[model samples]
Target chain A: MATVVAVIASTHHPFYYRASTSTGPDRPPFADEWVRKITAFRETLTRARPDVLVMVGSDHFHQLWLDNMPQFLVGKAPFYDANWYNEEREFGLPRMKLRGQEDLSAHVLRAGLDAGFDLAFSNELRIDHSITCPIITLRPDADLPVVPVYTNIFAPPLPQPKRFVQLGQAIRQIVESWPSDLRVAIVGTGHLSLELGGPRQFGPHGPDPEFDRRAVEWIANGDLDGCLAEVTLDSLHAPGNATHGFMDFMLMMGVAGAGAKADYVDSLDLFHTMEAYFTWYPNGVPEVGA
Target chain B: MSRYLVDKFLYTVDRDPELVERYREDPRGTVAWWESERANDLLNCHSGEASTWLRFADDERDALSTHDYVRLFELGAHPFLTLTLFIAMFERDYEEPLGFQKQYAERLSGFTLPYPDIAT
Candidate 1:
C-alpha cells in the first residue's frame, strides 16, 4: 500500500508569485517575506519526495466559466500546467508539463463515487495559476507527476463546507488503498476573505483579520468540523468576502483528515487577501510552537 | 507613464476617493502633487490614453464623477473604459495580495518582485 507522507495547504494568490517581479514600493520587505515562506514550503516538499503530488485548487474564471462548471472535477490525463498572469515572466515559472497518475486518478474518482459523492472527471485538464503558482515553487524546472482536482468556489449552487472535508477523507482512503508503494503528498491552494469582482474587490482595504485568525486556529487545533461549523457562507460572504475560499480550505482538511496533526501553521495578509499556510506530519504536529 | 496611466488614474480616482475632492479643489495643483513635470504635459507625452481621463477631472464634479469615475471605464460613448476597469481589477489587486512570500524568497534565495522607477 502507498504511504501518504505529507498533507500541505496554502491560500495561494497570483500576487504571491508576481510579487517576485514587481518594482519599488510594491516589492516591500514584507512582500519579500511572503515569497520566502513559499520557498521554505517548497523546500519541505522536495524533502518529502512523494512520487505523486495531488493538487486541488479553485478556478478563477479561467478554464471554467459561468456557462459550465463542476463542484468537484479530477484529472485523468497524464499531465497539466500552471500558466497564466505572467507566470513565466514574473514568477520565474518555466512552461513545463507535470505528470498525472492515471491509474491513481481513476481510483480517486471511483472512490469518491463509491463513497456516495458526486464526482466529475476530466481527461484534458489544463491548469491555471491556482495549480501552477505553487508548482513553480515546488518543482520549477521539470516534471513532477501530479493529479489535478478542481473545485467550484467561484460559482453559485455550491455544496456545503462539510462536503469538501468529506471529499478529502475519500481522497485519503483512495490513496491508502492504492496497490503501488508510491508516496503521495496533497497540495491544497486558495484562501478566503477577498472579493474577486465585488464593489471592494480592488479596494485598498484589509480583510476581516479576526475571521481569518479564527479559521486558522480551528485548522491548527485539528478541528475541521469546528472550522466548518464556524465558517458559514454568510460568514464568508461579507463586504470583503473574507472567507470566500473556505471550500478550498475545507477540501484540504478533508484530504488531510482530522487524525493528522498540523506540524506547522501560520497566517499573513497582503492588503487585499489574508492567507493561511499549514503542513501536516503523520508522526505528530511537532512541538515547535508557531 | 502610459504603463501606469490607466492604473494610476483608476487608482487615484477610485482607490482614494479623497483624491477626488483634492482634484476638484485644485486640478493642476493636485496633478502636480501626484505627478511631477506639469500634469497635462506628462499626460500628452507619456500618458496619452489617460489624457482625457484627466480632462474629465476638470468638469463640474457631478458630470466628471458621473461619466468618468463612477461609470467604470467606458470608451467614446463615454469611452470603452468599463472593460478597462474590469481588466485593471483583474490584473492587479485593488487592495493587493499581500503576504510573506518574499520573506521566504529572501531567505531561500534573495527573491523580490521586479522593480522600476516610480515615486512611492
Candidate 2:
C-alpha cells in the first residue's frame, strides 16, 4: 500500500527561472540565493524518492485560453514535455520531461466525479511553466513520474475555498482506494503574496509578507480552517498583495489530510514578488477515518 | 413600464419576472438582475432573436445553479464599473465590507473584459 508521503506548496516565481539561466548582470543577488534554496529542496525530494508526484498549480492560459478554459483539469498523458514562454527560451532550459501516471489521473478524475466534483479530463495537454519550474527545481533531470492537477484560482468562477477542501477529501479517497504499491508526494506551486500588472507591478506595495507569514504559520500548525478563513478571494488580493495562487496550497492541504503538518523551507522576495515554500507531511493521527 | 412592455420584454423573451421585479425594486440589484437574466437567456434562449440571448447557456444542464448565476454576476461584471462601485459600496457600508468585489477586480484586471457589444 502506498500513502501520500509529502506535500509541498511554494511559489513558482519566473524571476528565479530567468535569473538561474540569464546572461545579464541585471540578475539580482537574491536570484543566486533562490538557486541555492531550490538545490537544497531538490535534494530533499530526491531523498524521498516517491513513486509518484502529484503537482497542483495554476495555468496562465498556456494550454487552455480565453476562448476555452476548464475550471478543473487533469492530465492523462503517459509522458509530457515542457516549453518555456517566448521570453525564457533565450536561456536554453531544455524542455523538461516527466513520466505520466495515467492510472492515477483516471482514478482521481473518476473518483472526483463519483464524489460529485465537476472536472475536465485531458488526454492531450501541454506542460506550462507552472509545472515545469517546480519540476526543474525538484527533479532537474525530470526522472520522476507526475500527476498534474490545475486550478482556475487566478481565473473567474474560481472554485470556492470550501469546494477546494472537498476536492482534497475526494483525492484522499482516490489515493487510499488505489490497489498499487506506490508512494506519492504532492507539490503545489504558486505565490504567497504579490499581484501582477497594475500599480503594484514589480513594486514593494503589492507583496504582503504579513499575510504570507500568517498563511504559512497556519499551515505549520495544521490549522486548516484558520488558514482558509484568512484567505477570502478578497483578502488574498488585497491592495498590497496581488498573488492569487495560494488556492493551490488549499488543495494541497486537502490531499495531505487534515492533520498534515507543514514546515517553512524557504522564502524569497525579489522585485516586489514574494515566493515562499512549505513542505507538509501527514501527521501522527489522520483527521478523517476510512 | 407598462404591463404589456414588461410582458413583451420579460415573458416574450422568457426573462424571469422575479428578476425584473427585483430589478425594479432595488436600483443596486438591477445590474445583477439584468446579468442573471442575460446569462439565463444566453444559456437557454433558442434561435431567432430570442436565441441570441441564450448564447451564454451551459452545454450541460446541471452546471448552472442560483449561486452560480449570482457568481456570474459578481465575476462577469466590467472591472472598471465593478471597481468603482465596489469602492463606493465599501465606503458606504463599512461593517459588511465587499471583499469579493475587490478580489474580482484584482483577478480580472489582467484579462480583457467580456462585455458583449450591444450594437452587434
Candidate 3:
C-alpha cells in the first residue's frame, strides 16, 4: 500500500509570483514578510520528502468554460501545460510544463468511479494559478510528478459543500489503497473571504475579517462539524462573492480527516485576503522535522 | 436576458490579445462587429456549424458596447469575467497598483449583499 506522507491546504494568491520575484522600487513593502512565511511553509513539504503530489485546485474560466464545465475533473495526461495568456497578462506568471503521474491518475480515476464520484477526466489540461501557486511556494523546482485534481468552485450551480468533503475523503482512501511503494502528499489551495469583481474587493483586509478568523480556527483544529454547520451555498455569499472557494479547504479537511489537528498551521493577513497554510502528516512525522 | 452570451463576449475577448486591444480601442465598433460576425459561432466548432440564436439583449449590448461594467454586473454577467477582461484593457491606464481595481470597487460600492444572480 502507498504511504500518505502529508496532506496540505493553502490560499492560492496569484500575485505572489510577481511580488516575491520583483526587486527594489517595484517590490511591495509586505513582500519580505510574505516570502518569509512561504519559506517556512515550503519547508513543511520539503521535510515530508514525498515521491508524488496530488494537487487540488479550481479552474478560473481558463480552459473550462460555461459551454461544458465539469464539477470535478482529474487530469490524467502524461504532462500538463500550466498558466494561460490571461494569467500572464494579469499576474506576470510564467509559462510552465509539469510532468504528470499517469499510473496514479489512472488508479485514482478507477477507484474514484467505483466509490461513486462520477469523476471527470481530462487528457489535455492547461492549469492556472490555483495549482501553480502552491508549486511555486512549496516546490520551486517542481521536480515531483503530480496528479492535478480540479474542482469547480468558480462556475454556478456548483456541487454542494459536503460533496467536496466527501470527494476529499474518497481521495484519501483511494490513494492509500494504491499498489505503489512511493510516498504521496495531497496538497490543495482555496480562498479565505475573497471578493473579486465586487464592491468589497481590494479592501485593506479580506472583506470579512471575522469570517476569516473563524475559518482559520475551523481548519487548524479540524472542526468539520462546526465549519459545515455554518457554511452553505447561499450562506457563503455573505463572506464575499468568491468565498465558495473555501469549500476546497473543507475538502482538504476531509483529506486530513476529522478531529486531526494540523501539525503545521500558519496564516498571513494580506491586503485583499488572508493567506493560510496547513499540513498534516497522516503517518508518523518524518524524523528530519521532528 | 442572454447573460450567457454576455459572458461569452467577455470570455472570448479576454482570451485574445488582439480582441482585447480592439475592444479597448473601439468598444462600439468591436461590440457591433462581434455581435454581427462572431456571436453565433460555436467556440469549439467550425464556423459552418454555428448556433443560430445567441444574440444579446439591447441593454446587454449597450452595457458591453459602452464598457459599463456596473450595468453588466446588474444584468447578471459573471463578475469574475467582467473584472478580468476590464482589468486587462484598463489596468495599464492607472498610475498606481490596483488603482483601476479600487476605482471599480468604489463605483460598485452602492451595491449591497445579494447583489445579483450570476448563475447561467
Instruction: Return the top candidate by DockQ.
Output: 3
Give lDDT tens digits, candidate 1, residues A85-168: 334433444455677899889888887788897888888777877787667656665466888888876555567777888888
The 0-to-1 C-alpha lDDT of every candidate, in the order given, reads: 0.60, 0.58, 0.95
For residues B1-120, what per-residue lDDT tens digits would candidate 3 score against the true structure?
Answer: 999999999999999999999999999999999999999888865658888999989999999999999999999899999999999999999999999999999999999989899999
List the candidates ranked by lDDT, beginning with the highest: 3, 1, 2
Evaluate every candidate with DockQ and list the scores.
0.03, 0.03, 0.89
**Model 1 ranges off by over 4 Å:** A21-26, A85-96, A202-205, A283-290, B1-85, B88-120
lDDT of 2 by residue, B2-96 (tens): 21121122222222335433533453445444435543332223544333333222311111223222232233322222232233323333443
In order, the B-chain TM-scores come to: 0.29, 0.25, 0.97
Worst 10 residues of 2 chain A by lDDT: A281-290
| Each prediction's RMSD to truth | 13.1, 13.3, 1.0
Candidate 3 residue runs with Cα over 4 Å from true position: none
For all predicted structures, in order, the TM-scores are 0.67, 0.66, 0.99
TM-score (chain A only) for the predictions, listed in order: 0.88, 0.88, 0.99
Per-residue C-alpha lDDT of model 3 across residues A92-172, encoded as one tens digit per residue: 999999999999999999999999999999999999899999999999999999999999999899999999999999999
